[model samples]
Target chain A: MSERRFPWEAVLAFIFGAALGLAYAWVLAPVQVIDSAPEALRAEFKDQYRAAIAASYAANGNLTRAQSRLALLNDADAYQSLSAQAQQLLAAGQTRESQQVAQLASALQGLAPTVAPSTPTVPIAATSTQAQDPNAAATSTPIETETPLPFYTATARPTHTLIPTPGKPFELGTQENVCDESIGEGLLQITVQLTSRRQLPGIELILSWSGGEEHFFTGLKPELGNGYADFNMTSGVFYTLRAAEGGAVVPALTAPVCPAANGGTFFGGIRIVLQRP
Target chain B: MKRWVWILPALVIGTALGLLYGWVVDPIEFTDLTPETLRADYRADYILMVAEAYQSEKDADLAARRLAIFGSDSPAEIAASALPFGRENGFSASEISALETLVAALRAWQPASGAAP
Candidate 1:
């Protein structure tokens, strides 16, 4: 008579081989694709493509073509995508890009006419405050001086009457999430731009969350961009972003989950973009 | 036959299944698609958008640089390639005109093909 032996060793070998093969196939030698449609792009890359399309529309002032390009993203609602991106770029502190996306979205909605709207007169109040704050502005202001010192403001220009427009609302244009562990918890990166896409330096950004409110100004890091400022956040707090200039309230901002560089995940950082929409 | 012989066959079968699962049934997704692989209609619209931008910016050198993303094709050739597509697909005369304008600039343009920035 013969006795049957269990095949436990063979079963163990099969499991080990399967794991090894899967690791090799999926991790070591995955397929390499050189081409893909913009519609099929990963989320972050799709954001970049939307920005380029917005920029191209800005340069061309062609609504039809802009719409056509937006279609390539295959968004169910191109306007919603543009509007969403406008906020994201703003929250990311990309003032120029945020304005471009906002303008493109506006144009698509027919609110911003594709016809180059005659340049709105610069808010005289906004201009004077920006011009006086910089030492380079001294050269622009042009007084008889032998040497201009860095960070020096010329005192002679009489302050102009604060126009009614300075009192105008800034209207929150966009707010976006940025999840990077490098940006410490509850960080808010803010940038403001004019309708013309020029960064609006010196305007104040006010943050009010739950029981507390704080304020800051752009141009704190002019090297970063004209309208740039940052704030550290505390965990578990909800925040609202507002303009000290009477308008533009972005409510309900909180940190979203973001992946860490070291294979961990954390939740923090909100970027808000504000402009005279 | 020895029990060890059965082990080798089982291991081989397991590996084959695993490789099939990873390579075919659940392959990694493609995320960063370059511009060259766009569908034909999308490609034409992109060129037309470039041409529209050219109309306003009037920067032939810049337009040439943008078209260069397609690789291995002269900017002029790329613009020209889109015209037939534009016409067949009911592109308006003005839209077609923008494409033509781009082609003209690209044709005469050079490293001193002499289109102004």
Candidate 2:
């Protein structure tokens, strides 16, 4: 009968252990889930983060490049007193210091719009609203009203010259619309009418440009009854334009009129206009 | 009777301790970013981090944003949508340049590609 007694000490110890375990399990574990978050969402965050950094660097690099150019322009005596090495750079023609100077200047000036909103002090929600809803800007008075750059509308008409003309690649051209002046200093609005000799079913035209660095704009849907696409630009910057199809770059069917080297059937033209902003 | 007195308590205690640790410590150890447990749990801080990075507009922001985005396994649609946020909230030239590098890095990473990595 004595041996058949309830094990009071053992029972108490068991209860104590169970309680402690439960406490640890319930209280401590949840914090981990709260910390790491979901993986898919994590990836999204990373991508945005990267893009932000790249943009910052590019903007700053352009700013520095501009300041350097300004310094050179200020020093005429420096140019006159150039060493043989400096003179060689000028003669090589490979380094267009003058053009570079102009580009850097324009880039720096253009950066104002991008830079103002980028300040860390500014609330992201505020800027985000402004972007998603242009009208949302009215709710809060902006730090400063932006002087909207006037945009000019231009018409581009394309005329197909010859297609499938054996080695001639397709060709097309449109008369330049010089009737209206471009708006803003050093601005160029190019409206091009594009067409193919034959209806290449399921074909789309892609236009890409390399300015300060490679920039691309795709999905140029054809215009009504006329295959047309328009691209905007600011002058004094180097641009490389290409016509692409089926995920490949090909020469333009029609000759480009502006930049001298774009004369061949597949070659496109480059234009640089000097205008006051 | 003597065996039952100690054996039963020890088993119960051991089980309880195991359960407690399993519920608490195991999850955290499994999910943290430590090399061994990298995949134990998914993380979503990349989004907030990127957003905050853009808000900063400092040159460092761009680089930070890029680094955050490139290392994750986010969806394409979400990635595409985030671009305008970056553009409108533009930062200094250096920051923007960093963003460019970040884009290039993510582009090159090309994670698994279907929808989400």
Per prediction, fnat is 0.49, 0.19
Where model 2 places Cα greater than 4 Å from the true spot, the runs are A1-43, A56-252, A255-277, B23-25, B28-117
Using all chains and alpha carbons, the TM-scores for the candidates as numbered come to: 0.45, 0.24
Residue A179, candidate 1: C-alpha displacement in angstroms: 40
Candidate of highest lDDT: 1
Candidate 1 C-alpha error for residue A70, in Å:
3.8
Q: Please give, for residues B42-76, the per-residue lDDT of candidate 1 as tens digits.
A: 56656776675676556678677667767778999
lDDT by residue for model 2 over A1-277, one digit each (tens)? 3556666667666766766666566665433432232221233232222222223222223233223222321223322222222222223442322222222222333311122223333211221111111221223222122322212111121211111211222233333322222322222223222232211111123444342433222112223111223344443344433323122233322223242234432223333211111
Candidate 2 docking quality: incorrect, acceptable, medium or high: incorrect
Model 2 alpha-carbon miss at residue B104, Å = 31
Best by DockQ: 1
Per-residue lDDT, model 2, residue A236, is 36
